[model samples]
Target: MLFLAEKRGQGQVLPPNTGDTCSNVTMLDSRPFSVLSTSVKSEIRKALAPDILAFAKATGISREDGFDLDKVRLDALQIPVNNKKNKLYIVHWGDMLFGVNGAIWIVEVNSHKGRNLIAPDEGRNRGRSFSGWGMQTLSSENGSYPELMFASKGYYAGGGAKADAQCVRKVGAFYKINTCPAGCDDNLNSR
Candidate 1:
């Protein structure tokens, strides 16, 4: 195969080595994926805007289909990971901030690697107490965000601090961004 294809100048050509059959062979496809268009990128960023309800209502997107991707909002709110790791995500109904004042829908996550709101890091924030939401920069290069403020239910059972969990749900805002920077060409073949 190497000898026949090289003669046609289809790719890199190699000379036959003495008594070596696989000398000029390698196993890997050197193709790049289609990058997302700037417009799509912008849309993705816009979709993840802390004010998703406003955009959804404004865009006439009422609800999402269980498996239909068209119903999912695309955006760029992704956690930084290895270059080969997948960045795409599916927004769950529970994972969304839905309400009029969407600001109180989230709690704050302050970690060096930042926090994935959907999947809170328990190792770092276990039993660590936070005073309150005085105020701070709600956003950064990571895009706009919502604070996942915490509060104790103030109840106990069997002397153990039995606490109930609930979001502020006041002015809470955030959009679920489901997308790929490398545009959707799932087959991954260049046209």
Candidate 2:
């Protein structure tokens, strides 16, 4: 997707605000998802902040009293499922001062069942014991089903642990951990 950025005085510039929205924003003629807008990005952040915050709280990650909504980056990707139902993966990540915080939320549009599969990743890996997650989906070797994978390389100083897990899509709540090759860390595993 094409993204536009704004320039400021003295050659300072801001990161590309691909999530921005405004009344005058319009889509590019040839691109269905690309948008150009002058206003700040606020719509999705406002709508999803509560769920994000709650996820963090449930995982026991201590965050600052308030988060910078403008710093949040929201990404939506369509997941391929048969004709059964519609699935969209929503990922949100941002800097929360002391460290960065990131979370992935799965939204089942047709069923209206949306939930957080993992807690937000916060603080340094050394301090937190687990590095930030790398997420992707892999097809089962046996051709039974597809799996949403969350992998993390951890710090030995903290606990000498690592995590690799595959979660599958269900009807109501999706992404259940099928296998954790790294021997999951209870504190680090949110699902």
Candidate 3:
């Protein structure tokens, strides 16, 4: 029993948001509002795990301790970078039992440099970079925190202050720091 509207003159029925990836689609039913089937969720996680783990390794977190599978949460919005060919995967995880609270990690897909991770921290001073725990919540526009993209001027302390905010974006495989002066926000400590 399909309860959708059928256009009188239109010959074909097209689903909305066809331009977007099928991963972002949601099927509505009469039962109740919730996530899709477990199989779909599992596939999403399976596809994301490798990339996320690679990012973890790059950030100095060993693959074994990279991310707790039980705690990992994946965001549905997998959008491509504006003009770049790479896509972004937003993820969230935390060890509530251990009192770690919350943390978000961004994964860049199809990047020439393999995997990239962006972890933001508010307490870190701007214009300087340091590596430690996790990132702070700047925005959750697409269900998950997406502000890691705007944390240009702030410190990015992954792997013991490997690079300043200016060099965070260019970080490649194994946390290799690449220089990109154009992406930097400003030379001053804004935060």
Error of 2 at 121 (Å): 17
- What lDDT tens digits, residue by residue, belong to model 2 across residues 1-191? 22323333111111222221111111112211112121112333444567656545655654484544444444443344443554343343422431322344443333434434333342222221122234444443423224444444354566755443334434224344355334334423443
Candidate 3, residue 146: the lDDT equals: 29
What is the overall TM-score of model 3 with all chains considered together?
Answer: 0.30
TM-score of each: 0.17, 0.43, 0.30
Off by over 4 Å in 3: 1-41, 48-71, 74-77, 81-87, 94-177, 182-188
Q: Pick the candidate with the highest lDDT.
A: 2
Which structure is stronger by TM-score: 1 or 2? 2
Candidate 3 clashing pairs, residues 3+ apart or interchain = 120-135, 130-157, 130-161, 131-157, 131-158, 131-161
Q: Which ten residues in a row have the lowest lDDT in candidate 3?
A: 25-34
Cα-based lDDT at residue 62, candidate 1: 62
- Candidates in order have lDDT scores of 0.25, 0.36, 0.32
Quote the lDDT for 148 in model 2. 47
| Candidate 2 wrongly placed segments (more than 4 Å) | 1-47, 55-71, 94-101, 111-131, 140-145, 157-172, 181-191
